[model samples]
Target: MQLTKGVEQAICIIVLLSTQDNHNPLASDTISEHLQVSPSYLKKIMRKLVVQNIIRSVPGNNGGFSLAKSPEQITLLEVVESMEGEISIYPDTGLINKVFRDGVHTSKGEAVLHDVFNGANSLLRDYLAKQTAADLLKRTMEQSEIPVLNWNITNPSNQNKKE
Candidate 1:
């Protein structure tokens, strides 16, 4: 089963929020600007995250978005589920039963397929659940190729502008 682009953005948003200093909230505009994504589209994803309690929104002028829970507390699976809903790798459409008339063979085939798909789904979910946003952030930080960023700075574009 493939995940949507929203899921990828949601995870990145979490990683961005995790970089906030002094527990300060980062504005959606800032986040969108940094990621080079549309603010409107990011809002939709952020709304889902807020509803799932993955992130929180502030209402004042100095308002923005922040993590509702700690990075260590947020799981990759939680973010995935928040964006895409529950994961169901196999769609039980009953097409196999419809095409195959032999009950014994049909039942055996269905059982085997179900077992394999279920196992795969469970493995994926378990792996995701075990990996937290902090874990991902740490791994990312360990990579020399990726630049470590400070979300608290007045740096939405990650560029040096001439004054």
Candidate 2:
């Protein structure tokens, strides 16, 4: 099943936060600018993450968002679920019963289909739960030359805020 754009953005936010020198909080505006997402949309996604305890919000002049847990403690599944809710890839819509004229045997067929889809969904959850944000961040760093820029230092407007 296809996940929402918010899921992708949440994952990216986790990776970005994990990369920070001290896991420093990142402003929503800064994140939106970096990810090329609209500030409003990003805020919605960020709010979900916050509710899940996957990320925490920092308030005040130099405040923003930061990870509530270490990257190693935050799994891919957690971020995905935070953005999209529980992962139920397949929901039995009872369409199978309507499609087959043999209504008597439809229950068996539906059961069989349900078992198959449930197995697949379980596998997906296991795979996602096995990987953590640290895993993604590590892969990102290894695959590309990610210039390390501390937001407090790089963003001049934020420099005075930190002081």
Candidate 3:
């Protein structure tokens, strides 16, 4: 259950946006520059985010992208789902049986197997739903022992200049 590259970048974008004051909108190029990702690819990802209403894209010279809602109002799962679709922990019974030493197949409508999948999905959904963007930004700041503004560590030339 790993997040896709786009999903991961979206979360990073969310966290960076969360750190910004006044929900200031940033252009795709600025974001791509900071993220070290291709601007064109990032534009596609941003489009998905915009369509999902997780972020809003503004047009015009002074316009860019901004959070549609506050960081606290945004859930990590929502951001993930927006890019990756719904999360489900489905079981591949044939694969499961082949890997197990006992070689017992659980593909034929087994009650226990259904329960296992349901339980796993439920737990993951609950966790993801509970983790909001606000929490992520806060945790990252605390763990790094750095100011929120430092999230812009991708300031390219500056990093090289430091060396």
Q: TM-score of every model?
A: 0.83, 0.84, 0.75
List of clashing residue pairs for candidate 3: none
| Model 3 global lDDT (CA atoms, 0 to 1) | 0.73
Lowest-scoring 10 consecutive residues by lDDT in candidate 3? Answer: 154-163
Worst 10 residues of 2 by lDDT: 154-163
Candidate 3 per-residue C-alpha lDDT over 94-117 given as tens digits, one digit per residue, 9 for 90 to 100: 555554545344444355677888
| Better candidate number, 2 or 3, judged by lDDT | 2
Q: How much lDDT does each candidate structure score?
A: 0.83, 0.79, 0.73
Model 1: per-residue Cα lDDT at residue 40: 98
For residues 77-154, could you state the per-residue lDDT of candidate 1 as single tens digits? 999999989877999888889767789988988998899998988999999999998878779667423233566567
What are the RMSD figures for all models against the true structure? Answer: 4.2, 4.7, 5.8
For TM-score, candidate 2 versus 3, the one ahead is 2
Residue 64 error for model 1, in Å?
A: 0.9
Error of 1 at 70 (Å): 0.7
Model 2 shows how many backbone clashes? 0
| lDDT of candidate 2 over 54-112, digit per residue (tens) | 98999998789988988889998898888888888787888898877697679788888
Superposed on all Cα atoms, model 3 deviates from the true structure by an RMSD in Å of: 5.8
